[model samples]
Target chain A: MVENHPSQASKFKCEVKNLNFYYGSVRVLKDINLSVFSHQVTALIGPSGCGKTTLLRCFNRMHDLYPGNRYTGEIELDKINILAPWIDPIEVRMRIGMVFQKPNPFPKSIYENVAYGLRVRGQSQRSAIDETVEQALRNAALWDEVKDRLYDLAFNLSGGQQQRLCIARALATNPEMILFDEPTSALDPIATASIEELITQLKEKVTILIVTHSMQQAARISDRTAFMYLGEIIEFDRTQTIFSDPTHRKTQDYVNGRFG
Target chain B: MTIDNLHQLHRLIARNRFWEKIFIVFGILSLLVGIITLLALLIDMTIDGLPRLSWQFFTSFPSRKYEEAGILSAWVGTCLVILVTAIAAIPIGIASGIYLEEYAKKNWLGDIIEINVTNLAGIPSIIYGLLALGLFVEQLKLGRSILTAGLTLSLLVLPIVIVTTREAIRAIPNSIREAACALGASKWQTIWDHILPYSIGSILTGIIIGLARAVGETAPLITIGALTFIAFLPDSPFKSEFPYISFNWLQAEFTVMPIQMFNWVSRPDPEFQSNAAAAGVVLVFMTLAMNAIAIFIRYRLRRRIKW
Candidate 1:
């Protein structure tokens, strides 16, 4: 049994209740229940193939893109079940943004990359797009580096800059929540630290759900952490508690680097 | 470790190196065979036809006098037919390719369609000429005009364009598609915004190469009954009247470079054989120009995009 935090004051931004996910009839995530607090960073940490990424993807209905992927139960955002069949996945995606594992910037200019989401949403005013693009790039901590070359191809940027460009792309849409899937795994230590710092700062504006292979990353940035093993959450608690005083043996062993 | 072991290893390495040298020589020889043959033919054609290539030769029409006969009618017909072919083939071929690659579900029916499309490229070009004869010429009652010839060649190269377009689209990374979709773009939006822009360069390269093949095609045009001798050009695609553009050129009788060359070569006069050689050189140059354009576009686009 997982105990509630002593202070239950934070409002729930999203709540996953009895959520199950499957890939072509093979269950990958089993009965995941968790709460994501508003304006807080929640990190999902587990060994590879433990369904952490799958669970993260379910929040925005990313699984809907592929055939034969199924989801059951509820992923309620602000008390509304987004997993309902009638709810268009496009609507769900519009409200939530995602940064992929590697920097997958479009083969376009940096400004266009940041402006793409806005363009998709039909924000056609030139001034509004420029302002939002500037603000988003600033929020991603990339404005100073790339402002002079806004029209330069995104591929011209370094790996870290490209990742930030992708983040800016997601941010330009003004999504309520952002999901990062191992956003810094492809970067060096310096780039990774910058991105980690950016995520910590971003929580004041948008709810963040990130999946990371590194427990240290979750420990440093996440307000709350969920340690998953073999398709189930072994423990979910405040980041400190999960790292220092985990309730489950598997969580304790996994967090301590004894075994995965 | 041991001197004897070292000697054996050296001998083995030497033997392998000898085989590598032999293979390199063989590869170069194989490459030279095709290059030398082409060069020899080009040189022979130049020798036979260089004196015949004059401004008047390009500007004048075919005549009984060998020296007076030019390729004005043939080249104009070729250009008009190619224009029609490009107009007919590019859109239909590209749209079909996009539909198959992006919209079609990966099922048994899709598999069958895919196999048939691949097989279409291998079918004889003459078969396409026959189909065009039945469909465009006889059934539609269109004569052996530029439109009929163009449509015939279009049918012959449509498979090439479709196959190449699919290959180009398939080359795009899945991540690019996901990024577009993740940003709330609908399927059509994703395709229009990302897929088409990225793949346009390769699709064009494919289209031009297909057209180059179409340019050199003699069998299909002949099979569809293109004229062997013509003294007049097709109607100008532009007009001085209202609307300014004309479709009359499409319905005008035509003859292309290859057909002209074939007609000259079959004539009893040796001077006409020289005319055939000159026409052959110009035809080869036209094909080369199209390929060069394709290569240039591919290079430009490749430099702009990576991964």
Candidate 2:
């Protein structure tokens, strides 16, 4: 069992309070409260349609891209309510990056894929962009494979390399946090292991909020785990506690492979 | 479980296979019917017209003497008009497409506009010419010149461009937009940097196809008062003086390939029929070339893009 540290409360990077999400007229997420610690991975594990992905998207206001989706709640990042009406979702997104389940590299060169976010932030200097692209690629552990052919089309990369390229893309902007929505769901087992290892290493630099369907994946990478059932967090505790000694019967049943 | 039952099921499978074979044969026959008709017409046109194709046939102006007549004025007019059509239609069509697909709210008004845009493509080409006659020629006083004809064709093909642009843009997956937006890019940034670049190849294919259709059009140009016989070319768009460019050619009188062909075919001279056939060959080649270019571009661009 991982011991509870006294300074854990001070490391709170994000706090979600009484969050409710709606897709048009349908209420998708119920009142939910959760806390994410700085420089730590917090995994949300739930069955399909349990609102895990929706809650993760709320952190960056991704629902704003589509029409009729709505959110009512406070998602505070660094004590700032990112969900405030006046706060531009674009601004919020800039500070918090996201990697999707599928490896969706742009139809562009590998270098351009990594450089896109920096370019979006108006970083026009060629040297600065080059440096950041290299650093981000190295950080994602994809530099060695693609460094020699950075100008090749990103689609040429293998599935694993493409997912890592996506990770590198998300990391280029130096975002405060990164969201992973089943980032390895589409990858093979070997690729999934590499991605899981990379995510564990990534928590040393940026806070992570991952929504995973695989309970084993959550236990493997996350320091803290939140078991969500029916749009609500059923249990929030250390990964060790959630798997070995969960207070909620739902969490126990889910982690034991009995039910989801 | 009985042998009699097995025999009946075998017969059913055999019947389905027979229908499948019949469908394959019918599909090939239908395809060949269209191909053979086009090939026969092309062969006949070439047999009559290929002998007449020469440097002189391309460079000389129209004349009463069919042997001396060439398509210089007609071809030049067609080129300039197409240039104008491309310029006027491309930006407007693509912008409208982007606005409708990306920016417009999904509502009753948007739905109505979508249906109207689609219906516009089905409208007769003559209607566009008449509308242009009233709007551009009379109300705007643009005169029966290349500018007027080009604008008329632009309006005629605008729906084609818009529809195609929308289709190309729609083919880009939703994940691409999400990826761009997730990177904190503004809506315009996403479109300009990613959406436009990805969809440009398909959009260009649509534009060339529209232009090819515009090239073969006759009724619209005729209604717009395009001349059938012309002895001189429009003034050069390039100049020797400062600024070195001119718009005078836009306002000059013009004739197109179809108009010239029509005039020859209607003439009482047997020799003029060969000239018309020659013009028909060139027109068909131009359309075919444009389509080939579109196909080539689509092939090249699509090779690098995968979902």
Candidate 3:
């Protein structure tokens, strides 16, 4: 479906070179060498605990929260060493925003929720924050549902709406890359379609990296797909090619639902 | 006898049942005694103390001849002291709770602090008084004064305040903290802006309960050496021998309700015994009122916090 998209021919923007990760004594991700093109939705698909979530977290170093979690080698964003000791994990996270599996909104009003990131980095003016919150919400396709109720507590919103609000909460910071970890896993079909459409739309402006278990969803939304098995990537290629004629037998088998 | 011999093995089981029922009855009867004793004590105090309760108890000063005097000064002193102690404990306790829960790293130092705080909460009140005597009185030279006694009580109740407050903070889900964190707020900013407001209702409830204990404390204040009789209030904590200035924050040699009640009970006058009962009633009401307020707030918070 990507069909001659000019940007698809571009070389790697984010290179993962012999990147390895571990938690305590167990390795969650083997040496993974791949490249994610800029402004493309490269979906990582695997069985549960196949290191899909772990690899997604590696993009922003969010895995640091887990005890004894460690990463080796390089995940380069624009050829800069993101995994090296010199980088601040917080700053890397700032550049790479994230949304969790569950919508975790603060016990705050919608406006406050979106403006919170800005406020923390020390933005005080009312007009500036208001404009940014509005812009972020509009970008996430949540402004139409929540514009009139911006002052209401975010928990009052429906689950799908809350997830969008969380997306807006992340986008308010204006990060270059956004990570979605099963972003639509908790939503119904209608909401899932809306989020899928939103992510496809979002890919035009912000580079996206998503982890999902749904094979149909991976084919439907992503431009490129990576099949991972037991912490190792079995294949990575154009989505259409991978689905139709996968190079690796395991990759073809996984896409055909013959095996996971 | 041959037919009954096969059934003889179950006889001991029936005997065991009899003793089990007896022990169960004994446990029930033991609990009954405590409940009845409490009810009797309440009834006796109400009957004996009701007659002596009047404006006289709230107006006159204590006298050496107990028949002519009242506990107005002691009552006023206890109120003033507890108020000050609460004012000091609430903020420090809540801040420490928030810090321990939200910011403290999971490390040996944090574990050490947690263990020390738990141990401090279990220590006897008299030990707190001794600690105060050593620190505030001898080392700092605050003197054997009302301020010193009130501080001793504060220190005695502080550990409970901290422990309860930390529990209240912990009851909040980690998802909430993560939400705030994902907002790009720094750790302290997230705690200050979002987490603290949600946890305040429970923190205040713990504080009110702490205040109740602080107000009812008699041993620590006695250990800090409060006077049973002071005709006039002192201006400053250092001015124990002064022509009474009646200041609120600083106090020198003042009697609280329990100290006064103990002094009155030890008196030979049948009249003083009745007054002690009245004082006991006042003490119980103060604690009960505070406890009721805390419970009311807790209920309202439970209903109000939708998430």
The regions of model 2 sitting more than 4 angstroms off are A1-9, B1-32
Clashing pairs in model 1, backbone N/Cα/C closer than 3 A: none
lDDT tens digits, residue span B1-307, model 1: 9999999999999999999999999999999999999899999999998889989888988888999998988888888888889999999999999999999888999999999989998888888888988988899989888989998989878898999999999999999988998899998999999998999999999999999998888887887789888988777778999999988888888888988888889999899989989988888899999999999999998788999
RMSD in Å for all candidates: 2.7, 2.4, 4.8
How does model 2 fare in lDDT?
A: 0.93
Top-DockQ candidate index: 2
Compute each candidate's TM-score over C-alphas: 0.95, 0.95, 0.87
**Sorted on lDDT, highest at the top, how do the candidates line up?**
2, 1, 3
DockQ comparisons of all candidates to the true complex: 0.81, 0.86, 0.45
Candidate 1 local Cα displacement, residue B291, angstroms:
0.5
lDDT of each: 0.91, 0.93, 0.82
- By DockQ, the candidates rank as 2, 1, 3
Instruction: State in Å the error of residue A243, model 2.
Output: 0.8
For model 1, state the Cα shift of residue B177 in Å.
1.0
Tens-place lDDT digits, model 2, residues B1-307: 8999999999999999999999999999999999999999989888888888999999999989989999999999899999999999999999999999999999999999999999999999999999998998999999999999999999988999999989999999999999999999999999999889999999999999999999989898888888888889999999999789999999999999999999999999888888889999999999999999999999998888889
* lDDT by residue (tens digit), candidate 3, B1-307: 5757757857878888999999999999999999999999988987878777888877878887655678788887888788668767777777787788766787899999999988988888888877888898889888877668767877777787888888877877776766665555566776788677777788878888888888888887777777887777545434456655445446456789888889889998798888888888888888999999999988887654666
Candidate 1, after superposition: displacement of residue A75 in Å? Answer: 1.3
Q: Per-residue lDDT of A152-255 in model 3, one digit per residue for the tens?
A: 98889999999999889889999888889999999999999999999999887777888998998899999898989999998999889889999998887888
